[model samples]
Target: MRNLITFFILNLLCQSLTVNADELTVTLLGTGTPIPSIERFGSSTLIEHKGKYFLFDVGRGATIRLSQIGMYPSDIDNIFLTHLHSDHITGFDDFWITGGIWQRANTLNVYGPDGTKSFVEHTQGAFSLDAFYREKQSSLNLKGLEVNVTEIKEGLIYDEDGLKVSAFRVDHGAVEHAYGYRIDSDRHSVLISGDTTYSENLIANSQELDLLIHEVSVIEPKLLQSNPKLKSISKYHTSLQQLHKLVEKVKPQKTVLNHLLLIGSDETELSHLLETKFQDKNIDVGHDLMTIHLR
Candidate 1:
């Protein structure tokens, strides 16, 4: 009975954030791309450090994913966006409005590359009437409805209270300015590669990292056979074939692949293939609502 009680306590500690105050609490809220899937929501990651909740990207169903881990949209204040891609920022509108409704009294601070301000403005504009109705009809915090936007070009954008974030450029096909983030909090460092096709800049920024959350593009064999044109889409993201080189170069302490392309066969293929190839490396295929307590 004593052992059983200890087991339950350990399980709850692993699932939630009541323990490990000094470590970086990383959660993959959504690991899927624009392609819809019941398993993966979209491209959203939640980072908790120094008692502050920092969200990376607000893709589709982000709020739902957050709720799964006993968190709500209102708990997040700092959100760093990699780019303005539809798959990446589609859930921002929902996170913004719903957070305010749920009592997020502080302003939503958003950091991203150029055109991010315009995107936020347009998103708010599209939901103008709804915001107004809620403001009048409900007991929502007006300040929470407000958002603080920071459009960054490069270099260190955020530095305060032991948190530092650097934004770097990446190659994403036709997109002029897709970026990734290097987030560090004294004890732990994490790199998030938002939709990119193997950028050398990532290598420059990612060194001695505790956790590396990167994207991998792999369309299953059947999907490619059915629609050969879809192969071009892989050009925009780092393919499974090219990922080993990046992993070798960056050589992070740990790697979690995010923004996974759909189809169960491919997920299995990715696991089995990488398991054989990256046998010595600590790598994992991320799933939605997956939590990691970085030590």
Candidate 2:
């Protein structure tokens, strides 16, 4: 009877640990493009796990959305970038400067592609005056303002305290080394496909993804005919049609359409079109500050 009771207690403990191990929530902080929208901000996502925060792609207005969630610039110590596009990295100034002034003790750990270090260096140089002003005013630590950049290739970049982040290369048109990232914990896994056309690497890595956040564009026939410029743009991004094919292959538990570029069709129209194609799967358009919990 004692052995039976011990077995029951041990099983309960194992179940509890498994459930607690992968507690995470993802929030779409910004979901707009370089072409501004009042409703949507730029491209940014926040992953919050066990009081620690990780930011992916800090685009315009990311700090504002972060504010909505009660998170300040200093709260996010780790940031991962998919590529070095202007729209994606524009929030660096807000994050670094605000954090530098407010919470100077924390450090910003940035991970990205080959040019990441150079980009951070130049950005810091641009904000040299601001840093100097803060330094003169207060004896703040200013360490949080310091960005530690790790330029990554197609492999594991971060693994600490039971969470793992892996980076893989993807095709984003003329961009040389764009990437997608897979973040895994004990009970849940997520894949973030930062602006890409279509990637075989993404499909292979996403077999176990609980949630997949991917960039998508709308390419309607009328839009292409109306604006010749869209033809060039279409080559660089994944259309709703292409995304349909991708979702069919990856078959994630849930798929989110992010970095949405609305050319001719509005968000509502585009969503209905995509939903028709993905009738068998769960898919939704991402909006700023939308949060999803993964258990």
Candidate 3:
């Protein structure tokens, strides 16, 4: 009996070892903001690990971009939302109704910070007519149209099969409970800083992570001077200077900028500015559809 138990343990260890050799891929499905852009879409990210697909923040055009990446809306069952911001969740209806169209039979599991339940409930309520129409007029499975919303706090919200996700609080101006997420798999770990000002909580949670994807905005004095509203907005989002300090503290292997607000400079210029600040560190200005693989 003891020999059999030892053999089972060995087999499990070997399986784990083999799994570690596989790569986890992160695809930036959309890297733009609320502002419309032909070159970029709103904020959505897809993390594919061990054949499982997890999505974070379904912004505008998320499902369309997912289709572009060879994934149907029905392929994703688990979605984590950082906040209830319009830009972050505008694509919810698209994903929901479209997935229904594609015969998604599984319940959509959505996780988010406090107020998420109300947000989703209201959203579903708003889509009641469309949902009812689809159900009556089409053969789509309305069961998958059902969303299971889970409001999360600053802790481990999900853990299964060596994949874990933790949520932490972030300051988004007056928004009380915005969140950032840390995703840990068997081999790689990543943190996504969903629209936030520099938070010590984020740095503490993101220590030595494989990748840190943080939001950043251009901080030009003239632009801020000209647009008082943008200046106010800047207070809620991280400036390049603030990002430099945050990156200096957290020190992830690679840092990618997302939710870019290009008020002063273009993408290349913004990337150049970031590179100059963190000369020794690896930095990439995120763009839509950019895929990074972690092995």
Candidate 4:
């Protein structure tokens, strides 16, 4: 009887682990460019694991985009900013406003690089007048809502409840200091290369990751012909060929190309080019609202 009880306990523990392992899901919220599009927003990605929601890079329209997917701003437990670029942080104000209006009881945690605290303070200051008026008119006090800002460094930024998140510095040119994030749970890991140029560090850090989501730009002849300035900027971003090489080296289980530039072209050819370079790995082109289950 004692042996049978021990056996059943071990089996139940194994089943619980398996169920928790399959709970991580990544959702691509806004897989578009700085320039607005009818189909896509800017550059936000939502990660859900073990009943917790984390938002990375809340670009323009991210709050509304979340609403479209049946998630409120309050649903986000943590917000990780890759950089302070306008395209990346523009929707932060909207997130603040929506969370305040809804009167969420929980405090929101915002994490980012060096200037994160000042940025949040400035944003809060900008909303001060509006917050005052809302407080006067309604039962909810907007200004009373807490927004905790933590300035992050290189190593592990967050670790709790079997989930660990780390940040690595990435090259995004002189505009701002940028970072790529890696999130690891017990059974799966994901890497997000947030608007970076091709970096050896990212490739090394992302090796054997379950999912690698990196930005990609197109350098086809027609794009170069249309806009010379855009062509120059594309050099600072990751090109299809560069991404192909990175995938070849890191060899992640799946490679997702996102933050697409020069889209509406032959995406299949681009995927095929990447696949030929990194054989035996799944290559996917990201679209807004696309969800991938991480097992």
Structural similarity to truth (TM-score) of each candidate: 0.89, 0.93, 0.91, 0.89
Query: Candidate 1: which pairs clash?
Result: none
Compared with the true structure, all predictions reach lDDT values of 0.86, 0.87, 0.88, 0.84
Ranking by lDDT: 3, 2, 1, 4
Looking at candidate 2, the ten consecutive residues that score lowest on lDDT are 98-107
Q: Model 4: which residue pairs collide?
A: none
| Stretches of model 2 off by over 4 angstroms after superposition | 1-14
Residue-level lDDT of model 1, residues 114-218, one tens digit each, is 899999999889988887887788844577779999998878988887888889999998888888999988678999999998889899999899999999977
TM-score top scorer: 2
Clash count list over all predictions: 0, 1, 0, 0
What tens-digit string does per-residue lDDT give for candidate 2 at 1-295? Answer: 9999999999999987778667889999999889888788889999987778899999998888888888788888899999999889998888778877777566689999989999999989998877788778786556767888899999899988778899988888889989999999877899999988878888888877899999888867887978878988887789877888888888899998889887777888876886677787799988888899997
TM-score of 1: 0.89
Which stretch of 10 consecutive residues in model 4 shows the poorest summed lDDT? 262-271
TM-score of predicted structure 3 = 0.91
Tens-digit per-residue lDDT, 1-295, candidate 3: 9999999999999887787655678999989999998778888999887777899999999998998888988898899999988889899888877887888868889999888888878878988888888778885567877889898878999887678989999889988989999999877899999999988888889877999999998867898999889889999999888999998888899998899988867878886786677888798888899999987
| lDDT value for model 2 | 0.87
Best-matching candidate per lDDT: 3
lDDT of 4: 0.84
